[model samples]
Target: MPVPVVSVAQMRQWEQASWSAGRTEAAVIARVGACLAAWLRRHVPHNDRILILAGKGHNGDDARAALPHLQGRAVDLVEVRDPETALPDLERALARGPDWILDGLFGIGLNRPLAEPWCRLIERINQARSRIVSVDVPSGLDADTGRPWGATLRATCTLTLAAPKQGLLHPAAHTFTGRLEVIPDIGLVPCPIQSELCWTLPEDFLDWPPPRPVAAHKGTFGHLAIVAGSTGYHGAAVLAARAAQRARPGLITLITPASVYAVVASQLQAVMVHPWSAAHPLPGRYTALLFGPGLAAADLPAEIPATLARLWQEANVPIVVDASALDHVPRGPIPRDALRVLTPHPGEAARLLGTTTNEVQSNRVAAVRALSGQFGGAWIVLKGYQTLIGRQHGPIFVNPSGNPDLAQGGSGDVLAGYLAGLCAQPPLQGDPERLIRYAVWQHGAAADALSRRHPAWVVEDLVRTLGRVAPHRVASTARPATPTTPP
Candidate 1:
């Protein structure tokens, strides 16, 4: 199961409760130190030179406690505010050029800006060539907001204690909190039972692509219908269809505007393409529908609203809405029985909410929840840094796998089509929420994998890399594990 992300205040509350329950502060600090030291010994080589920057508070106490276990190495420990010889000690340590620097300075509770000497020290740390391991939250970073308090230490890895801080999951903090590791069981217990946010890890997808029968044919997998593309944006439809193909849907039929039909048809040999028309009824046999992506509002037929209404009301299949299709959502409340998923970036979400992008980005959780409620139990994927997936009456799923490489155009279209394809698969049918989550995971996982080879990757690269990922298969009769927390 994924772990909960708590704010600094919540963490403090938990710490106080633990202390009242007989775990003393000193004892907690000792355990954290021991665990951190053990983790370091296991991951870091014993021969590497180490420098420990200790502050005056419990963060420093934790680092001090670890000294006993980190013996036999050239380790230098400097207390930030020590009056006698702190500066000389720091200078000498810097001169030695330690292989690793363990930053135990101000932690999550810090809210104020850094002072002169501390600021200088942080600047030096940032300039250093040594790898940095930050204990708990990195110094000079707001653990609640993921914003830097001034000059913050950029860590090679952050050893977060107990639960992950809510701020660390913020997209802006990814560079500073490189490769987050949550240290479990450091005297903090009885974790908050419910939280608005939870982070997704790779381990959560260990049982993906649930097994299929050997005797099954293409028809057994299921088919999907994609309504996307316009005159100039034919590439959008091609990307979506190609990504859907990579996801292994049984069959894909694309309904596109006549202006772009020939180009899209020529590019895609496997997918069946049909020119969209209001004169004819939409094909109704597919198990899932993916709407939007490259469609132009000006070019939509006069009867499109009625056409969409009919498909949504009578088709009784999962519909994934994105891009231009989102512009046409009925202004009134959606039907309670509708099975729909809306994949919108902040701008599109803001348009649906009649608000600004700033408002949507500022309070993404509330925006997604409001969308779900207003749509009468619809599922929503608010795509951005830490892409969020939420359904009516369900907690948000925070995706932690994507990077800046996915910030380009047409990425959301690929995500929408990929999700639609997953929904069309037999194993994912009737579970719109899980289907969306798994698709989001796969989308980011592929981007993450491709980023290691190239500095920048286009949407097509993501489509091609999807096939290289190894799918975990289970017994045909097996079911996906129910997440402990709300999924």
Candidate 2:
């Protein structure tokens, strides 16, 4: 199982438990520091200069603990005993201008904002020209709320101890946390004591979507029906088809408006293309369905949602509702066993929930949970930074993949298609929540890898990258992975 979220109170309880088990604080700090030092050695050059900003808290102790392992590097320390008196020491260290600055001023124990000289000290650190790496939680960030309490300093990277802090995974915390990497085996186990979120890990790729039988036929993986497209938005359907194709679905049937069908058909080779017809809105049997990519409300008939809902009344398959289709999700009671997955960005989520976009983004975890309850999607994927995927009656997952690369035009369409394609694959459809998590992770991971080659990528680049992360894990084959530590 993926690691669950942990709050400061839970962390304290864990500390007490570990203490009862004869695990001392000094020993745990040493282990955490050693693990971080190992990771730094792998990521940082040996010759680079390092400067440590030590504080009076445990965060500072953790940073100072690593000093022994970083022997060969040019290192210096600025101990902050009294910020008012330590300004001279801090200035002298900052003037040296080391290549990397380790901010170890505070951790999850902090509940109030930084006061007086502490705030000025952090501000001065932020002004320095070196890359900053925070030891755990940033100096002034609220570990539980995932917000800057006050006077927060931004970091180039955050080398966290044990499991990652839940606040660090917040969408709003990225600016302060930078690239995050967890230092493991320090004895902090974030069990299911109290948390609604779990972090998706790379190991999830194993044993999922199972493996190809080698003698498999086209019908083995099941059929995917993608209903999308309009006149000017024909490319949306093509992108969805391309993504689904890369996802390795056995057969793809793309249904588009007749006026745009020719354009979409010309852009694909394997996908079977069809035109929208009121007489038979949805035609054959399908294992899964993807709907609403680039569908223009002006183009679709007023009664299209009702007609499609009536046609799919008895179907017991998973459906990915995305883009404009979110507005037309079939009304009335859904089929007993049918799985409905809704993918909505903040704006679309706001429209569906009858709330403002700010309200949804402010507390994405709450918004996602509310979405599943109000909208009734078996899986609700709230798409944004640190995308949150919520199951109707299960715990939500926080996906830690992708970057700014996914803020493009057709990326949502690709993700929607990928979700449907994964659902179509047999054996893997048994676990609905895990399947959605896998799909969302792979989608962002594709963006993370492709973004390296180009500063910005078209949705097509993401579609092609899906082939690399596709779920086809066999007994002996391991899927390729990009380390969480940024290169």
Candidate 3:
């Protein structure tokens, strides 16, 4: 089943539904506790002493409910109602140094700052040597923005309840939320609430570039022209071209400067190369134009902006602007309703949105949408901890795949290539929005697949692993193969 993502208000509505359906809030809490207990018993090993910090709210009730279910495992339960004496067990756990500390003090509904003893306990938990597993959310941390009040507990693993809270993906929450695990509580199944934020999975990316016809020739697979690389940054172009080539065969033609043509050509086998004089615009002769990745920062002979403007005016296809190209392009009302795909990281997004990096980070959702409007792209993918995909008119989809391992350099280049391949695929229902969603989902799915096998993933490895990432396909006779006859 697709993962359910919801905001705090939505979660409340669901909780209300659960209560109205004759299931008490305590029953829902017990269901959550049971899931936590079962997981701990299976993975956490026996004799692993657990110190659970319980608060006054339902989140604290969840901790207390899980205590009896610990069975023979040693449990130290602390009730945090006041500052000094409220967290005795938590303090003792910190002082004695337990193996794992469970934070069940607060959930996503926390709006106010943490007070005294709880704040002190959270600080000690942060400074502790033991691994912490926060239930629902880490104490002292805001579930929406991941901002910590006063002090917050840094957990090694967090078991989010029902749905993944928005805070878990926040930059400030990354260190605290080491490995996020979402668990489904059966008792909450009857809840009538719907989700506002959803974790996109491979299943959600159906009906993208429709299934290909076996009888189709190379031309059927849309052609992609890549304008990348310069004298110094050939690897970026090579990576992008190779990734795109691997994604769709025989449809990619990478155009680069004459100086590095041999270097880029030698490195790639699947993608064709066009060596143009560094002084000319890429000949208008393909389905899409992918620019950036190894594009020189130094002044080009014809000037890249003018060349891009010409391409936009002449070329009647989608154009993906990234990296250095984004740096050069002037921001204003778009020229036409071109199928433009902009791939920018946080810093780049900040520049494109005319705001500081901090402002972009503060509200990533707002920044991406605003930039998409400014650029008039059919799709925009803003890469970050929670990668966001923006369509011309639709809800923003947040990617659940990838980890801190993807934070390395050259990752964005690989993504640019992936998007190109997806854009080249014929739409399932001739809808461009579906293609954008599928492409974003597939890009993350590829990373997710790699991370499963290699937790410590690198950008080069991700680029090389593109072939292993499968596309959405359905069995049908409508696209059957046909034999070619020699005339």
lDDT of 3: 0.70
The candidate that achieves the highest TM-score relative to the unseen native structure: 2
Tens digits of per-residue lDDT, candidate 3, 365-466, equal 778778877765446788877787775455776775566677776777887887777666543225555565666656666676777677887777787776
Candidate 3 deviant stretches above 4 angstroms: 1-7, 21-27, 34-56, 61-99, 109-113, 144-146, 164-203, 206-220, 277-285, 297-304, 328-338, 391-393, 428-434, 441-457, 467-487
lDDT of 2 by residue, 264-322 (tens): 89988899998877664453578888888868747675555664555445567777888
Query: What TM-score does candidate 2 get on C-alpha atoms?
Result: 0.88
- Compared with the true structure, all predictions reach lDDT values of 0.78, 0.77, 0.70
Q: Put the candidates in lDDT order, highest first.
A: 1, 2, 3
What does candidate 1 score on TM? Answer: 0.80
Tell me the tens digit of each residue's lDDT in model 1 across 1-487. Answer: 5667888888888888887788788777777777767666665788888889998888888777677767676788888765244677787888998998889988887999877777777887888899998999888889999989877999988888877898997767877998676665576667754587876655566665667788888888788889888877888998999888888889999988888889999999989998888764464678788888888647665565566656655566777888988876654455455568889899989989999999998788899988887776678899987789997576788875567789898888788888888877776675666667778978887887788678777888999886455523211111113211111
Residue pairs with colliding backbones in model 2 are: none
Pairs that clash in candidate 1: none
